[model samples]
Target: MKNIIKTILLSVAVLGMSSCSEDKILDLKPVNNILSPDAFTTPTLIESYMNGVYNAAAIGQYNSTGANGGRGYVWGAAYVEQGECRGEDVVNMATFYDLTYSSTFDATSANNVYYWVDGYRLINRCNLMIEGTTDAVAKGIITKAAGDDYIGQCKFLRAITHLELLTYFARPYNDTPGATHAGIPYRVVGVNTQAEIDSETVKPRNTVADCYTKILADLNDAETLITTGNSTAFASRVVGRASKWAAIAFKTRLYLQKRDWANVIVEGNKLTGAFALTADPYAPFQNTTGRNTSNSESIFSIQHAATSNPGVNAALASMLKDRALVCISPIIWRDADWKTDDKRREEGKFIYTAAGIKYTNKYTDVTNRTDAAPVIRYAEVVLNMAEAQARLSNSAPALTLLNSVRNRSLANPFPTAGNPVGQAYTAASFATDADLVKAILKERRIEFLQEGRRWTDIHRLQKDPIASVATNGVPAKVASAATPPTAAFVLGNSFAITTPVAAIPYDDFRFLWPIPQIEMNTNPGLGQNPGWN
Candidate 1:
C-alpha cells in the first residue's frame, strides 16, 4: 500500500500544474513510468495506475486562489454553473465580474485562467488513463471486472469535466438553443485514427443536442462500469465515485439544465433511495465520524486522507497559507488576524474563545488535522430529492423534503435562538410547478451556501427571477470606507457583525467566459464564447 501510494503521489501532484502554461514543469514520474505498458503488467500495477487518474481529477494545488486550483477543484465548475463572480470582483473595479465575463467575447483574465486549464487538464489525464487501461487489459494484466471498474471511474470523471465545461462554454441543453450553441470539444476512446486526431481540429460548435448526447453517453457507460465495482478510500466505489447514483445525479442535473422536469424528477428519485440522510445532518463532517462516515445520505463522495492533523489550519492550510490576500473575505482567510466574536465588525471567522473557531459543519474536527475533503454528501442527496420533488409539482411533500434539510443547518432554518430568523419559505398556495420551483430554489441557496453550489445553482435556475440572487442589485454601504463593518454575513449589534443586504447584480454579456486569449492565439479553431471579444 505504501509503495502504491508513493507511485501515485508523483502522478497526482502533477495535476496541480493545470494553472500554468503547457510548458509547465512535469511533476509526475517520467512519462515513461506513466506510459510503461510493462508497468501495468500486473493487476496491482493497473490498480496503481488507476490512482493517478482519480487524484488528477480530484486534487489540485491548495494554494491556487479558487477551489478550481485545489482539492475542491469542482468549485470552479460550480462557480461557473451558478454564474458566481470571483470574490475579488466585489472590490476590483478594473474587472468586469458576471455572466458577461463567462461570455467567450468578454471574459475576465482571472476567469479565463481558472476555467479553461482546469477542465482540459482533467480531461487529458482521463484520456491517458482510459487509453492506458485498455492496453493493460488487452495484454491480460487485469481481470475484466477490474478493467471495467477502472474504466467506469474514468468515464464518470470525464463526464463531469465535460458537463462542467459545457455549462460554461455551451448553452444549456434545450431543443431550441442547444442546436445553435457550440458544445465543448468532444473526444472519446483512443486517439488512434487520423479522423480522431482531426476531430480535435476546430470543428464548429456542436448543437446543444450533440453536446448532451456526448455527455449522456459517457455517464451511461459509467453507470454500467461502476455499479458492480468497489475501491479503497482513495479510489471509486460501486454507486460511489461517479457511480450509478452520480451518473443519475448528473443526468438529473443535466435535465434540469435542459428544463426537462419530468425526467429530472425520475432521475432524482432514484438518487433518493441511494442514500438516506443520517439522524444528525452535520455528523458527516464532525471531527469524530467525519473521515469514516458512510451513512445512507452519501451516494457519492471523493474521500480525502489526512497527511497531517485536521485543524482548520491543516484542513485548509495549503489553499489558505499563501492566500494571505485572498482570505480577507468573511470565510477562512489566512492572514486576517480576526480572532474575536464581534460579528458586526467581523473578519473571516468568529473566534469563540470557548468553542474555538466558527467552522462550517461541512467539516468539523479541524482541531489539528488535515481533514479529508468530502466532495459529495448524503445531505446533497436529500437536497436533490427535495428539489426534484418541488420541480415536479410535489409542493406539499417538496416543502417537507426542503424542511428536512433546513431543519438541520447549524442555523436551523425553522428560526431559533441560534439563528434568530429562519430563512423565509412561502408559496404553498402556488398555482403551478413554477411556483413550487421558486421555493425549492431559495431553499437550495440557504442549504448550499459557501459549499460552492450557490453560484452554479443560480446559473442553472437563472430564468426564474427569484431563484438567483443579483450581486450588483445595490452597492453595499459600509459603515466606514476605511474600516467597513462586516455586512453580508452580519446581522448584529454594536459588537456583533452586521452584514449588508448584498444582491447579485448580473450583466448579460458575461454569461459565458471569454475563451482564453492564449488558446485562441494557438488553437485557431477554438472559437470564443458569445460575448467575449
Candidate 2:
C-alpha cells in the first residue's frame, strides 16, 4: 500500500500514456521505472498527465475519491451528492449517519479523508505537469505555446482543487479575511523527491487570504492564456475540460465565498453574453442518450459515460431515486413559498415509499450513473450577480436579476407543460434589500436541493442551520394535497413524534471538520482545526 501511494503521489508525471476510446490517454505502466524527463517531453505525454488530473476528479461518493484504494476519478458530481447531505435541505433517511452531520464524530473518525488526499494527490500531478512543461519548453522539448497551454490547464485545476479543500477543511474565507485564519497549505511544487515531500509534511497552513491570493493568481494566469478561441480550437478533442469561461464562472463562486460582492458581479457579467439558461431547466440532467453538451445550461460540468458509472451509492440517484435513502427535508419541502410551479417539484420527483415517507426521484438513472454533474451553471451566475447587486444596495437591478431566474423556471415547465402555475416577484414585492436577499436565498434552497451546494451556501453566509440531524422525518401525502405532510422524528416512551428544531450555531466548530487523525499521525507537522482537540 505504501509503495502504491508513493508511486501514485511521486511518479504521476512519468506514468505511461496511451490513447483510449474516450480520448483519455491513461496511465498504463508498460515499464517499471520510467523517467520524468522522457515522459513529459512531448505534447502527447503532457496531455496524458492532464487527462490523469481530470481522471482524479471525485464523483461525490463515499469510496469514489480514490482514498483508501477507491475506484475511478470522473467528475465534480461526486462533490454534490456527498455535500448535499451536510446541509439542512436534505435528510439521510437510512441508518447511516454521515460524519458530516454527526455532532459526536471525532477527529480520528472524521470522514472525507479522501477529499483531502484526492485533492492534493491531483494537485501534485498538476504540479508535475506544470513543472515538466516549463522544463520541456526551456530545453526545447516542447513549444512555448504548448507549455503555456499545459500550465494554464494545470493552474485552473490547481486553483479549483485548492478551493475545494478550503471549502471542506479550512475556515471560511469570510471568517477572517486577513491571513489570520488557517487555510490549507498552498502547495504549488510537485513532491518530486523524498526530501521535498518531507519538507511539505512539516509546512504549516497558509492564511485564508494567502490561499485566495494564490487561487486568484492561478485563475488570472489561466484566463489570460485560455481564451474562448483556445477552447474552440480544442473543441473537437474534449468538450468539458476547464476553459476560460470555467475560470470566470469559478470566480463568481470564489468571490461570493470571500464576500467580494463587486468582483462577483464583475466576473458574472463576463458570462452573460456567453451562455443562456436551458430552455428546459432539467434537460442538462435528463440527457440520457449521450454525454454531449449541446443545449446545456452548464458553463462547466463533469461529463460521465454510461459505460463508466460512479456506482449507485456514489451517484446522485442513490440519494433520492434509486437507492432512495436520502430525502428532502419535510419541513422545507412543505414550506408554503417554495415555488410550487417551479419545474423542480413535479409529482413523481418525490415518490412515496411503503413507510409513508417520500423519497426524491431527481436522479432517474438507476442502471448507469452517467449524468453530467454541474460545476457551474448559468442560473447560479445570475444569482451571484443578484446577490452581489443586493449587497451593493443596487436593489432594482438585483430584483430584476432575481426575477429573471424565477421567470426562467416558469418558462421551462415540465410534465404536461405548465401543469402547476409559476410564481414571479418584482422589486415592489420586497420592502427592503434584506427581504430580497432572503427571497433569493430561499429560491436557491428550492432550486439547488440535492445538487450538493446547500451546505456551502449556509456556511459561507454564516447562517445558523434551521435544524440538526437528530431532527429527522420524511414528508408524506396528506389527503391528496399539493404538498406533502411534515412529521417529526420522535423520542422514546410516549411513542410520539414532535417537529424538532435543532440549531447548529453559526460559530459551531463542527462547521469546520477536524483534520482526520490518520493525516495527523502520518505527518507530524499537520495541525487539527480548533475545538477538535
> Which is the leading candidate under TM-score?
2
Q: Summarize candidate 1's per-residue lDDT along 222-314 as a digit string, tens digits.
A: 878874433333223432256666677777667766667677667767655445555654455445554424554555545445432222322
Query: Against the true structure, what is every candidate's RMSD?
Result: 8.2, 7.6
lDDT of each: 0.47, 0.61
> How high a TM-score does candidate 2 get?
0.81
342 Cα displacement, candidate 1 (Å): 20
Q: What is model 2's C-alpha RMSD?
A: 7.6
* Model 2 lDDT per residue over 422-478, tens place: 356765678887777778887777767677677667657653132222122211211
lDDT of 2: 0.61
